[model samples]
Target: MTVEEVVSMVSLIEELEAREAAARVRVEELESQIAELMARLEAERETWSRLRVTRETVAEVVAEMSVPDTAGEPGPEEPAEPAPVRVVGAVMVPHWREGLLVDALPDVYRDIVEVVADASTPMQAKQIVPRIGLPAVTAKIEGTPGKLKRLVERGWLTEDQPGLFALAHRATVESGEGAER
Candidate 1:
């Protein structure tokens, strides 16, 4: 090749190398910005999660405090007779003589009860896991079937067939009526 042609090619190579280095620096800056934004997003998400938990805890405390003590009288700090609380979209239900059955239930049993209450037909324990959104891995655990049978024994559910279970049709167990439980 001629000297002039070789000189032109060397200049072109130098320009291309400079552009490549600049592109790498820009990419690093963008990556740092992305990492900072991701960290901020995670912090905001954790704050939101904590707020949700605090709200739920406050609601439970208020509900429990609204109920009168077992002595058939208001607490000394409370008014002699507090005004009746009428919850919006809530139906008046007769107080259960046996107390809240759901209060005595474990989380899994309550989920089972809710699933059966919503179902049009009775469900077997095997059928219940997926309907209640339990993980597939949990369905394979031993004693899962026994848990459903125990619900029947506790009078929360009834066995319609050999293996199928349904919610007990009691006043305190019906939908809307016992929803507070």
Candidate 2:
């Protein structure tokens, strides 16, 4: 059209182009920041996971050691206090009687209970399968979910959420307070 109109349009175009380039640079910076934060988050998660596993393993070892070798006869008498119960992961397990408690469970229920008890958070049945070192095929079996549900019903475990499980109170299970169900 006119020279003046063409010049004005060119100026507008250059301004818009500069803004678009600045926006693109900003978007790239934000993307890079997000990627860095995600990497940090993953590293922190791995560290926390390792710490939780170590804590659980130490608790288990301590529990094993606390059980006395009661098989020997005729020792000098000092009135012994009951063993203390301690938190293992998120569950209360007796420092001396974990083995006895596990032994009291039915064969099918023991592994599942142990996995839930040792977890630092509540677990779903699907999650429990791998943690218990069961075959992936076992998760597909209907009985797996049913067994977990039965444990909840029996108060050996608690359903923390609709499908997530955790250990029930140690005293309730150990004292036979919840055994009637």
Candidate 3:
């Protein structure tokens, strides 16, 4: 073989090896980036899971608190005890029953019931807002509907038609003339 041809072949082989080494370095960098992104994705998924669990736990606690404990019953001869009062950080209306009174409700909820009971006709949330001592602003008016709906769900109030709230007929009859009015 000619020396010149041999030298040319050796130079071409060295150039190919240099290109291969550069490609390997680029592949390593991309692999590192992929690994980092995977770890970040895992962290985000864990955070999402924790938030969902926390929300579920809070809902469970709130549901359990909705019904006050009535474990100890008084003897028939003993004077009937007054219903236990439920003091809560947030508004919680207990389901109205034969024995439960408006007084058993939290202050805001009782105020809402009293306002509904006193009204001559079924009232809208906007109309009832001012009477409950809240300002007749958009925000206050907007927030009242949820409370009104919750009352209906708990049987303390009724919504025979949409957006019109009234004291439930059964609640009135059970609690006597005051609630009926």
Candidate 2's error at 101, in angstroms? 12
How many collisions between residues are there in candidate 1? 0
- Model 2 superposed RMSD (Cα): 11.2
> Which candidate number has the best TM-score?
3
* Model 1 worst lDDT run, 10 consecutive residues: 88-97
Residues 49-128 of candidate 3: C-alpha lDDT, one tens digit per residue = 67755664464368556544556785686445545434444344667777677876766777788888888899999998
The candidates, ranked best first by lDDT, are 3, 2, 1
Pairs of colliding residues, candidate 3? none
Give Cα-based local distance difference scores for all models.
Answer: 0.65, 0.66, 0.76
Q: Where in model 3 is the C-alpha error above 4 Å?
A: 1-61, 65-88, 170-181
Model 1 pairs whose backbones collide? none
Question: Per-residue lDDT for 1-181 in model 1, tens only?
Answer: 9999999999999999999999999999999999999999889867876775566446445544665665667668878644444444322221233546554444676777778888888887777887767755542433356667656765777897988888785544453445554
- Model 2 is weakest, by summed lDDT over 10 consecutive residues, at 90-99
Which runs of model 1 end up more than 4 angstroms from their true locations?
A: 68-181
Could you tally the backbone clashes for each prediction?
0, 0, 0
